[model samples]
Target: MALCEAEKTFVLHGVEENFRIDGREREDYRPMELETNIVSHAFGSARLRLANTDVLVAVKIEVDVPYPERPREGKLEFFVDCSANATPDFEGRGGEDLAVEISNSLAGAYRSPEVFDLTKLCILKGRKCWKIFVDILLLECGGNLYDAVSIAVKAALWDTRIPLVKSVTVDGNNIDMEVSEELHDCQKLDVTGAPIMVTVCKIGEQCIVDPSAAEELCSVGALVISVSRNKFSTILQTGSGSLHPQTLLECLQTGHKVAQRLHDALIETLVDIKPSENSVGFLR
Candidate 1:
């Protein structure tokens, strides 16, 4: 996201005036579009487009044994794939570093048990549990990737449905479980407390949320804060600039405020989403 001196100056002046180049306030996010159940094969799926930053999240459930230490808890894994279609620089393994960074941030954000309860996915203690694989695909790079990815992940989890376990039988050392035959007999994941990431970019002396590609280039440093309920789950600082303690606190406060609004808007949008007969993947 490189910009010339004049472009940077324009953005700086706009920020100083509390009006961005895109006609948004300093804390305003770009327009977003979300759709769920786009992948019929996966247990759940959702696609989100925050301006030009596009992300797709799919949840696949597999039965597996619980961990040795946490026998009653299930597992959640995150994988990020940056497609070459988004940018030529991501071809082959070029995007590995960025991919790992995003995936690790997601893992950390969901690490707290209070944010997402893995116990809900446990089938039989120590014997059987559902391992959820959250696969995220990046189709664009308009900026604010972390926020967009988190939103998509939450939407996918919200759309996910776990099959009902009807009965479980133990035959000596082996165990067999039967799932409900009815298609509608499923349980939805509780994502009310799911964390939402908000990127606070420092352009000049002002902090901004949801920076665009140009604004990202103008930023000296940025903080990615994950808000789960009323607390922060994780925080990562990026770029090559240092911030004072007071500035950091101010940035965190801004992130938390905007995250709450973002979370509320996401839930409202998801609730209003209706099943469409046609699939609107990337063709649109």
Candidate 2:
């Protein structure tokens, strides 16, 4: 939605005064609702609703050969799909560009071994490995898509369970493996190090987290910061606007601070979630 000159001015003034249109402070985020294990067929699944934006993520695992150069590490891939119902711009293939951009950002954020350790997924050296596919579906877009998607992906991965491998035997050139048949025999992924992304928008000399769609239209530029283990995993500048050196530094500082808080809250929420709890579907 395009905002007129007056609406843009109103948003700018709100940022300057640290009072947003939605009654949130500059560093404050909108209300969020997160649910896990929503997709029964997936190994893991999570859905997050941040204000008006909604994102659903699912994790699927498959046994495959590891990369030649990284035999000890498994593969992690991200795929994003923007539903046409989200926005008119997302109709048909129009959302492909945005989907690619989001998927690439996620891939980059998880590339560092410190952020997401893939070695735990390896079943055998230079042979069998678990390939994890993270599929993200954008149900709605109000703003701050990167942050919402990252949080949802982390929650889904945390809920993921990998089947237990009972035994692996090698004879001549043949290799055989046995997996535990019990549904209870599974290994849960450690997602404590997974990165949390924070989007900081620069508007009228002020940097704000969780910008609304109207506020985004009034911003100069934005910074997407991915934080892992209290450290920056990736920082990407978005929008065509340019920022001064000092402003850039300040933006980074704000992003880092907000990301840490967000991560802590997410972890606490995930811990409190019960596997048998009912899921709050899209109707909510």
Candidate 3:
């Protein structure tokens, strides 16, 4: 939905007045609903709806040989699929570029060991390891896809459980392993250090977090900031517009602060979610 000139002016004025059309102040996020462990066959899964944008994330694990150069570390890959029903623009192959961009950004954010320690997934150095696949499905795109995707990914990772290896036997270059049969004999992933991304849009000389589709069209430029454990993991500039150095600094400050608060709130919410709880459908 493209905004008309008058509609764009309205949004601009609203931002200049320090209030958005949705009545949210700068740096405030839209209402979000999160649910975890919603997929039965997946190792873990989560769904998040921020205002109108909806995202579902599932985590799957497989045993494979570790890369020779990084034998001590396991593999973590991200895949994003934008449903054509989400928007008309996503029809056919229209969303492929956006999906690739999002997947790449997520991969880069988790590349640092301090953000997500892949070594913890190693079953046997250079021999076998658990390769995690995080698959994201975008059901809708109201706005703020980056923030919503990151939060859902973190929650899904938190809910993931890895099967315990009971025993391993090696004979003449052949290796065999036994996994625990007990359903409860699994290890939960530690996602405390997982990065949270925040998108700050520079609108009318002020920066805002979690912009709606309409607001996004009104923005000149935006910054996507990924914060992990009180530190920045990746900062990427988006949009064709450029910002002055001072404004860029201010945007960073806003993104960092908003990301921290968002992360804390997300962690608290995940802790309270029960494994057997029913999913709150995406209608909201």
Over the stretch 20-134, how does candidate 3's per-residue lDDT look in tens digits?
A: 9999888778788888888989999999989999999999999999999999999999999999999999999999999999999999999999999999989888999999999
List CA RMSD, all candidates: 2.6, 2.1, 1.9
CA lDDT for candidate 3: 0.91
What TM-score against the true fold does each predicted structure earn?
Answer: 0.96, 0.97, 0.97
Give the clash count for each candidate. Answer: 0, 0, 0
* Residue runs of model 3 more than 4 Å from their true location after superposition: 278-284
lDDT (tens digit, per residue) of candidate 1 on 1-284? 46789999999999989999999988888878788898989999999988889999999999999998999899999999999988777988889999999999999999889999999988888899999999999999888999999999999999999999999998887999999989789999999999999999988889999998889889988999999999999999988888888889989999999999989888877776666632223212
- Which regions in candidate 2 have their CA more than 4 angstroms from the true location? 278-284
On the 0 to 100 scale, the lDDT of residue 193 in model 3 is 94
Global lDDT of each model?
Answer: 0.90, 0.91, 0.91
Candidate 2 to truth, TM: 0.97
